[model samples]
Target: MTAHLPASGTPGADLGAAVRALPKVLLHDHLDGGLRPATVVDLAAQTGHVLPTTDPEALGRWFVESAASGSLERYLETFAHTVGVLQTADALRRVAREAVLDLAADGVVHAEERYAPEQHQRGGLSLQEVVDAVRGGLDEGMAQARSAGDDIRVTQVLCAMRQGDRADEVAALALANRDAGVVAFDLAGPEEGFPPSRHASAFRTLRDASFPVTVHAGEAAGLASIGDAVHRAGALRLGHGVRIADDVHVGPGGEVRLGRLAHWVRDRRLALEVCPSSNVQTGAARSVAEHPVTMLLRLGFEVTVSTDNRLQSGTSPSRELELLVREAGWTHDDLVAVTVAAARHAFLQEDERRALVDRIVRPAVSPGTARPGRHRA
Candidate 1:
């Protein structure tokens, strides 16, 4: 390992410019949750929809303020305006393009934007149509980023809404387009009553076919939900699996004990998609200072930071990293470690992962630092 950061080091000294320039890989972003506020206004107007605020700044503020309500239900309600405006195929494409551009601007070299194709059918678009439109827009944005000398690649992770019954269909769609741009499958939505086990058939189908799968659990739900995501669904990554912190026991003398489930998670080397700001907005953490990501990292969990819902959380990958630096006092090595781990677990092919590490991640970390190795029980 490289030298430990000095206690008096100014971790966030050059956050805005220096940290923003580092390469990143994002695995938990939502397509609809990352729209530009101005684009949302334009799309709503084009679709004859009513918005809480027409001004871009106010609209953005509304989304952030509403999701900060601390109730999972209320936090999710902020997506209504975004999803409503994205009913049209063109609107979906535009948002997809903007997401790519925004991530590239924040130095994301690789990302998998996940969304439910089922939600965009209100305007008569087939599920496949929404998928294609989004893919096309991402391709356009990637080309533009390349033209601007930004080393970036964006892929799709098709998500099946947990509250619905279309998981199998979405899985099939992901398989059909896997060779093109669809890289993975995920189950995303309210995770309390509707567990990943509810979509066992879909997960079974994907598992038998050896498809990459992730599930949103342990965010709005508890450890059982995360267990179902891992055992029943065969998920390789746990989306917002921060609730595993609940299973940890701390002694007065600074000793830590992990429960069986938490031990299994760590021993298996499963990736935990942790989103700090989004976690706070949804009441997972009272504030960034109390976030469990630092603890999980210290405990040797395969923890990777992300901006789950940039719009609703009023954040970006750069902002998320900066927050950890300023609030949690993360060192440069800490930031580099998180970014490298995310790239390692990305849904890309082995060759792609290698190239990403070489071209984007390695330069961000200093020489002689220990790299994350793939280890499992």
Candidate 2:
């Protein structure tokens, strides 16, 4: 392990620039939730989908403001336009391609972009077709990035909407496409009333096949939802698992005591994909500084930072780290810690993750690693 670096001089413009230049790994980004504003405008025009405004700039503002509603249910409603335009294979392909390029430009070296395949079937495409289109787009973007002197590895995680009834079908689709870049299966959409146990058969099928699993839990709901994801759904990772903080108690002297559930999560080293800006918009946390991610990190839970939805949140992996440094008092060491955690917990095979940490991430953040002098400050 590299020796921890002390806090950089200041946490303003210089720090933001440094954070943006650091290499990053993303584990919880959503495909449908990260379309570029201009792309949305162009696709909506092609599909004859009406929008709040056709101008790309105003449309971007609309998404951010609409999602700013403090209710997760309301925040999700803003996706109607993004998903509406993404019904065609071409639209899905373009969005996936651009998403990869965007993440790469922001210094992300590895990303797993997820989406529910069932959502894109409204245009009469089969699930396999949808997967193929996205894979093609990712390949195109990867090739383009390499030509531009950047290298990135992007993969897919198939999601089954919890509010829908096609978990078994989605699981089968994931299994069929596993070797074709689909790395894992997940349950997304409203986490309040829908528990992962509802799709027990799907999870059992994947487990029997030795497939990896992740679940969106402890975000819109509380401990029971998280418990179901861990014990019943067998999730190797939790999407926005910030609510695990509910089970942790602090004493008058500031000593921390972990409840049984918290102990299980921490002791087992289950990674929590904490998206701070998105969490505040959904009322999951009061602010970035107050978010349980910092406390969870201090208490030894495996905590990783991510941008859950780039478009709606108006953020990237770099911007997400900048916010944490600016508001949560995170040092360079803290940023490096989360980056290492994300790489280790990514849904890759052990050798792949090890290579990513050893060859890419560690070299980027180590002391005296050459970066732009302007960013080094």
Candidate 3:
């Protein structure tokens, strides 16, 4: 029989353990939003940055509730605390490294955690310095994981804030470190007024350089935003492209009709970085079971599950898989499919991605083949 999860939303039985053991790939996670609560409290104290809660537990709770407010502004407000404390190079390194450690513990074989370099320059460090610090942290974290016998590999994605004026600068920064630890360039931050079109020139610069780019669209915005990100911005992957669900219509007899924009994304096999918990927290979906990822997967859209923010969403890749298995009714096969999809779309070289798939992902997902790893709960 095919592996299945328990009926309850909490998959503590075989399903939960199986989910945690699964070799996963994460495409969209934020560095600032995934800090350990105690680390945040310590960093805040060191930086003299006051936070909503000094208690680590309380501060962690605050991030989750605040993000669930459904107002992107309120959700983003939590970042001020995390980012405030992460201005220094050491702080950035710790956060990036620890974030990778956490993902490693979650049994993620490959991950790309992104951050806006422009936001981390308050400590008199140049943008390139910020990139170097974060890259260094990722290297250190992966090394530590390797020491612990956890097979994990991670890379950085340099993000440009949407409301900022440094998209091209960030793109260039990505290029500067592409040979190092950085894998891709992305446009992040609020997606409402400042659409991808606002950074068309920067996107063109990255695309012309043959760099991979993923745009934050279809989360706080709709199809117009998604269309622009794909057509105008040359996004190989879409950050929270959940609103692509808007273009899908179901007929009375159950036939599916996809809009042109949806057709373009689907036909191109563009990966949709679907964050279920964060989507509910942001009102993109009413609940995990109601997530459009269910439809996207059913329709054969290239859907890869991820945790947009670990501290804010209170989730990990394993938790994300548990949620889908318990609520979205996903099976082991489904998880394997998405993991492979993410590896294939990853911004790394073709050989590296194939190695991740063939050696780590494929073997681990097989019935008897095993790949050694660890999971955080």
For all candidates in order, the CA lDDT equals 0.87, 0.89, 0.87
Q: After superposition, how far is residue 42 of candidate 2 from its true place, in Å?
A: 0.5
lDDT of 1 by residue, 275-365 (tens): 9999998888888878999999989999999999999999999899888878887877788778888988998888888878886688655
**Global Cα lDDT for candidate 3:** 0.87
**Which has the better TM-score: candidate 1, or candidate 3?**
3
Pairs that collide in candidate 1 are none
TM-score of each: 0.94, 0.96, 0.95
Model 1 TM-score? 0.94
lDDT of 2 by residue, 51-76 (tens): 99988899888998988898899989
Which predicted model would earn the best lDDT?
A: 2
Which 10-residue span in candidate 2 carries the lowest summed lDDT? 368-377
| Error at 296, model 3, angstroms | 0.7
Candidate 2 vs. truth: CA RMSD? 3.0
Poorest 10 consecutive residues by lDDT, candidate 1: 368-377
